[model samples]
Target: MTLTKPQDLSTEAIATLIGKNARVYTTGDMLTQDFVPNRVNIELSDTREIVRVWLG
Candidate 1:
């Protein structure tokens, strides 16, 4: 993933955008019981139709 130039955007906006795709740990989220509200796990694989798993 590519990042934009953070020139005038606030930290909150940046963190929110990042949290949209990945996890973000902050003072408020970490302090409360909703630190990890969602799971951002991803499974990327190469284009292959093998019996098991084929990667290049």
Candidate 2:
């Protein structure tokens, strides 16, 4: 799915847009030890704003 640039989307919006099971990473949060490298990393800003969307 293609996301619009500079859109102020919330985590929920991003989750819904991508998928409920998609991996979400907020700023300062530690990466999961068992995290698998794939298309499921969604980075969010400090205010819970979507900053980046990952796809594999």
Candidate 3:
């Protein structure tokens, strides 16, 4: 996925795109512990827009 900063991709779209490259994908609030080690964790804004992407 050739993602650029501030891209207007939705959380679901980000998940699908990352899922294609990663073995697993997860989405949740920043305060939550919904993360899998060695997996991709996607953080989205309140409007469901991609805010951050990282490996847990």
Candidate 4:
């Protein structure tokens, strides 16, 4: 649940570390089908945020 920890670097592992209460966002390239996440925003006492943009 604590994000400031060094061991919590991997964003994908957040689901297991915090359980279903956490929020996860995933995106992919339209042509390549390659998944990528650009930025992550976290609100106070709220779940995490993931912002993905396709640079076409």
Candidate 5:
């Protein structure tokens, strides 16, 4: 949930760290409105690079 230099981390790395609780996608990807308290959302760039990370 808490990562240092998260931008330096890859989506797969995050998935490995967070397990099944993570949702990795790009900025223009469609996402559901329903929020899961324990889920982690990872947003990526157009180039498929990680841009942001948050808890939902």
Candidate 6:
């Protein structure tokens, strides 16, 4: 799925746009610094709201 404004979408909505191998996380969570070129990173707010979307 494609979004005109991904950061404005909900976590569940964005999750559906990604493949099964995507990475989903929220603020304050500890994550590895390693970068995987094909990985899709979805960052959510503390209240489980979608905040940002990007690829590695």
What would the per-residue lDDT of candidate 6 be over residues 7-46, giving only the tens digit for each residue? 5544465557764447788888898999888777878886
Residue 42 CA displacement from its true place in model 6, Å: 0.5
Clashes of each: 0, 0, 1, 0, 0, 0
Q: What are the models' TM-scores? A: 0.22, 0.47, 0.40, 0.22, 0.66, 0.62
lDDT of the structure predicted as candidate 5: 0.78
RMSD for each of the candidates: 13.9, 5.3, 6.1, 10.4, 5.5, 5.9
Which stretch of 10 consecutive residues in model 4 shows the poorest summed lDDT? 39-48
Score candidate 2 by lDDT: 0.67
Off by over 4 Å in 4: 1-5, 21-56
Identify the candidate with maximal TM-score: 5
Tell me the spans in candidate 5 whose CA falls farther than 4 Å from its real position.
1-13
TM-score of 1: 0.22
TM-score of 3: 0.40
lDDT for 27 (candidate 2): 77
Report the lDDT tens digits of candidate 3 across residue range 1-56: 76455456544665677663332222553354655575665566655455666776
The better-scoring model by lDDT among 1 and 4 is: 4
Q: Which of the two candidates, 1 or 5, achieves a greater TM-score against the reference?
A: 5
Worst ten-residue run, lDDT, model 3?
A: 21-30
- Superposed on all Cα atoms, model 4 deviates from the true structure by an RMSD in Å of 10.4
Residue lDDT tens for model 5, 1-37: 7655435546577778878578888899999999997
Whole-model Cα lDDT per candidate? Answer: 0.33, 0.67, 0.53, 0.35, 0.78, 0.71
Off by over 4 Å in 1: 1-7, 20-56
